[model samples]
Target: MEIELKPINIIFIAFCNNPKCKNTISIDVEEDTPKDDEITITCEECGNSIRISYEVDTI
Candidate 1:
Protein backbone atom coordinates (compact mmCIF):
# COMPACT_ATOMS: atom_id res chain seq x y z
CA MET A 1 0.00 0.00 0.00
CA GLU A 2 1.05 3.56 -0.77
CA ILE A 3 -0.01 6.93 0.54
CA GLU A 4 -0.04 10.18 -1.34
CA LEU A 5 0.70 13.47 0.34
CA LYS A 6 0.14 17.06 -0.72
CA PRO A 7 0.83 20.49 0.61
CA ILE A 8 -1.82 22.00 2.84
CA ASN A 9 -2.70 25.61 3.49
CA ILE A 10 -4.04 26.58 6.88
CA ILE A 11 -5.02 29.81 8.50
CA PHE A 12 -4.20 30.20 12.20
CA ILE A 13 -5.69 32.97 14.21
CA ALA A 14 -4.14 34.13 17.48
CA PHE A 15 -4.62 36.99 19.85
CA CYS A 16 -2.19 38.69 22.19
CA ASN A 17 -2.58 37.85 25.85
CA ASN A 18 -2.02 41.38 26.97
CA PRO A 19 -5.23 42.81 28.25
CA LYS A 20 -4.47 46.31 27.03
CA CYS A 21 -3.19 45.22 23.62
CA LYS A 22 -5.52 42.44 22.52
CA ASN A 23 -4.00 42.37 19.07
CA THR A 24 -5.16 39.75 16.65
CA ILE A 25 -2.89 38.12 14.14
CA SER A 26 -3.61 35.86 11.16
CA ILE A 27 -0.93 33.38 10.17
CA ASP A 28 -0.92 31.69 6.78
CA VAL A 29 0.76 28.31 6.52
CA GLU A 30 1.80 27.08 3.09
CA GLU A 31 4.58 25.34 1.19
CA ASP A 32 5.36 22.96 4.07
CA THR A 33 3.86 21.06 6.94
CA PRO A 34 4.09 22.15 10.54
CA LYS A 35 6.67 20.25 12.56
CA ASP A 36 5.54 21.27 16.01
CA ASP A 37 2.22 21.37 17.84
CA GLU A 38 2.83 24.84 19.22
CA ILE A 39 3.48 28.09 17.40
CA THR A 40 4.88 31.16 19.08
CA ILE A 41 4.50 34.68 17.75
CA THR A 42 4.89 38.24 18.88
CA CYS A 43 2.32 40.93 18.42
CA GLU A 44 3.46 43.71 16.13
CA GLU A 45 1.26 46.33 17.72
CA CYS A 46 2.28 45.79 21.32
CA GLY A 47 5.20 43.36 21.09
CA ASN A 48 3.33 40.88 23.24
CA SER A 49 4.14 37.19 23.05
CA ILE A 50 1.46 34.69 22.11
CA ARG A 51 1.36 30.97 21.67
CA ILE A 52 -0.96 28.87 19.54
CA SER A 53 -1.37 25.18 20.17
CA TYR A 54 -3.30 22.48 18.34
CA GLU A 55 -3.99 18.82 18.84
CA VAL A 56 -4.11 16.19 16.10
CA ASP A 57 -6.30 13.09 16.25
CA THR A 58 -6.07 10.18 13.89
CA ILE A 59 -9.13 8.44 12.58
Candidate 2:
Protein backbone atom coordinates (compact mmCIF):
# COMPACT_ATOMS: atom_id res chain seq x y z
CA MET A 1 0.00 0.00 0.00
CA GLU A 2 1.00 3.61 -0.62
CA ILE A 3 0.05 6.80 1.20
CA GLU A 4 0.34 10.49 0.53
CA LEU A 5 0.50 13.46 2.88
CA LYS A 6 -0.27 17.13 2.53
CA PRO A 7 1.51 19.99 4.25
CA ILE A 8 -0.39 21.97 6.84
CA ASN A 9 -0.47 25.74 6.47
CA ILE A 10 -2.28 27.67 9.14
CA ILE A 11 -1.23 30.90 10.83
CA PHE A 12 -2.88 32.91 13.58
CA ILE A 13 -2.23 36.21 15.33
CA ALA A 14 -3.90 37.84 18.33
CA PHE A 15 -4.32 41.55 18.98
CA CYS A 16 -5.54 43.26 22.12
CA ASN A 17 -7.07 46.73 22.33
CA ASN A 18 -6.05 47.35 25.90
CA PRO A 19 -2.71 49.09 25.91
CA LYS A 20 -2.15 48.42 29.58
CA CYS A 21 -2.34 44.72 28.87
CA LYS A 22 0.46 43.78 26.58
CA ASN A 23 -0.81 40.46 25.38
CA THR A 24 -0.13 39.41 21.83
CA ILE A 25 -0.61 35.77 21.06
CA SER A 26 0.45 33.83 17.99
CA ILE A 27 -0.37 30.27 17.02
CA ASP A 28 0.61 28.07 14.13
CA VAL A 29 -1.37 24.99 13.22
CA GLU A 30 0.73 22.32 11.62
CA GLU A 31 -1.66 19.61 10.53
CA ASP A 32 -2.70 17.79 7.40
CA THR A 33 -5.43 20.35 6.76
CA PRO A 34 -6.06 24.04 7.28
CA LYS A 35 -8.76 25.77 9.29
CA ASP A 36 -12.29 25.47 8.05
CA ASP A 37 -13.76 28.95 8.53
CA GLU A 38 -12.93 30.80 11.72
CA ILE A 39 -10.64 30.62 14.72
CA THR A 40 -11.25 31.60 18.31
CA ILE A 41 -8.66 33.05 20.60
CA THR A 42 -8.96 33.46 24.34
CA CYS A 43 -6.87 35.77 26.46
CA GLU A 44 -5.50 34.17 29.58
CA GLU A 45 -4.50 37.42 31.22
CA CYS A 46 -7.61 39.55 30.60
CA GLY A 47 -10.06 36.72 30.11
CA ASN A 48 -11.14 38.16 26.81
CA SER A 49 -12.68 36.20 23.96
CA ILE A 50 -11.84 37.00 20.39
CA ARG A 51 -13.36 35.34 17.33
CA ILE A 52 -11.37 35.55 14.15
CA SER A 53 -12.89 34.78 10.80
CA TYR A 54 -10.98 33.32 7.89
CA GLU A 55 -12.13 36.17 5.66
CA VAL A 56 -10.35 38.63 7.88
CA ASP A 57 -6.66 38.14 7.42
CA THR A 58 -5.50 41.11 9.48
CA ILE A 59 -6.37 41.18 13.16
**Tens-digit per-residue lDDT, 1-59, candidate 2:** 87675555677888865666779877665564344576767877787777877642332
* Model 2 clashing-pair count: 0
lDDT of 1 by residue, 1-59 (tens): 98776555677888778889868888875546554577777899998877778654433
The pairs that clash in candidate 1 are none
Give the deviation of candidate 2 from the true structure as CA RMSD: 6.1
Q: Judged by TM-score, which candidate is best? A: 1
Give the TM-score (vs. native) of candidate 1. 0.66
Candidate 2 lands at a TM-score of 0.57
Residue runs of model 2 more than 4 Å from their true location after superposition: 1-5, 30-34, 55-59
- Highest-lDDT candidate: 1
Residue 25's C-alpha lDDT in candidate 2? Answer: 73
